[model samples]
Target: MDKAKEIFKVTKKTLLLIAGLVWSFAGFRVFTIGLEDIINYRGNKFISILVGSVVFYIFFKFIFLKMYKKHFIRITTSGLDKQYFFQFFDLKSYFIMGFMITLGILVRASRIFNPVGVANFYIGLGFALFLSGVLFFISFSNTKKIKVQ
Candidate 1:
């Protein structure tokens, strides 16, 4: 039991680190490379994109995660007493995550926005989305029970 809890702690930290790294790298690259392109284009649309990305990130990091944590608690009490894992086996989450990943891949792989700063913003946004989805997916593997002190 203690071993399982220890494993969960390790895995959770690792996932969080990986997610942070992914976002950091993507943000760095986007700022350094995308800024120049954005200046060249001289379009104001990048501002909107940047604002939108910030909003989305906040929503996911706060609202979405909170909802998921609640969902996790609910599921843990539903006869899965020995586990405190992520509950993501439902089709809704699958579709939402799949769509986000696919969209990110497509945006990152396409050259249509190469000359625009919005492209870089989207590239970073997509990478973050994909990474977060992966974090959530891996979050489902724990079998540890959360003990109340």
Candidate 2:
């Protein structure tokens, strides 16, 4: 059983890489979708894009950056030699992710808000997520250096 469990476990470095890749890919996909929606918007395109850019900057600085730091500390402080593959994110994170995904899908499908408005929000969110992923990669690289030294 231990050997079987080991097959599904991964080192912290690998967890970091996996988290980075997953977040980056999801961010890119969401960002592109927002971009496409904004392109199709008939309103003031420049202002819409500008608003989205501002949102991105604010969220990246205030929210996602802090989240990255917290999670980075958590990962570095964990005592486990290896962890389950899905343990890259804590339980709270998994719940939050699931909720956000469900809400996003429902909102989009129901057209509860203007598509352009949603696009702006998505753009900001996506960029923040992408930046967080980049932070993870940076930490991962630093860990590699630590191991080498």
Candidate 3:
């Protein structure tokens, strides 16, 4: 029983730590896009990122927090087995999640190759990837609780 509890605690901490890393990576991409836009386009991309972050925070408060609070409570109070937390993360989801993280890395790595020889296009692609990263973060955040529609 003690060993099981220790393993469970470690697993939960690892999961949360990974989530935090993903969140920070997404934030980094957003910030990088803003800096690139300012340097390349001389526009208000930085301000836009700030606005977007504020909007995301507000949305998370009203929606994600409410939804996930119930989920956390249900999972915690039900002896973990009732929730079957690991079952929610099947093989397919793992594959897809791995692909997303790999794609994000590849997108950032492309900056090194400069295969296109077009700076504007490269920056635009990066910004598009920045959007994708934000979407990835949102999707991953909600994966803990699968909603049936």
Candidate 4:
């Protein structure tokens, strides 16, 4: 268990990615890099694609990992002796992941406002939907076993 914690600490890609995503989003433009070719390049519409991808990718790594642990608790609660913070964290992550997924879908679906490349934007949103759906389902099952202290 300690080793796994150490690994999570060392492999902080998710944290970095989230920070990067937030920064990128604040600076995003409708066609910062795609204006040159509105048809294929999508003009400024690609910003949504990149934002959704980066945001969802971070959630895939961190939020989904939390759901996996919650599922593990459900499948086999043998060794889980009514611990503390685990329960709260799992619940919190569950809802947050759901929100992220919903937000990603909205961001991608908003491509219509950009004037081009709606399909590419949705590609990123699709991954978020899939990742969030799996994680939420896993966590939902674990909710039944509250393991009260």
List, residue by residue over 43-110, the lDDT tens digit for candidate 2.
89888878888989998999778877877777666787677878778899889889988998999999
Using lDDT as the measure, the top candidate is 2
After the best TM-score superposition of candidate 1, give how far the Cα of residue 23 lies from its true spot, in angstroms: 12
Per model, how many backbone clashes are there? 0, 0, 0, 3
What tens digits encode model 4's per-residue C-alpha lDDT throughout 1-149? Answer: 87655543311222223323432342233223233234465245557567657755775577545554564444335343333323323466569747865775575567545534444444443454354444444444434443422
Q: Give all candidates' CA lDDT scores.
A: 0.49, 0.82, 0.45, 0.44
TM-score of 1: 0.40
The ten-residue window of minimal lDDT in model 1 covers 80-89
Worst 10 residues of 4 by lDDT: 10-19
Candidates 1 and 4, the one with greater lDDT = 1
After superposition on all C-alphas, the RMSD of every candidate to the true structure, in Å, is: 7.9, 2.3, 9.3, 13.2
Off by over 4 Å in 4: 1-43, 78-126, 135-149
Better of 1 and 2 by TM-score: 2
lDDT of 2 at 37: 98
Q: Residue 123: error of model 1 in Å?
A: 7.9
Q: Is candidate 2 or candidate 4 better by TM-score?
A: 2
lDDT of 3 at 69: 45
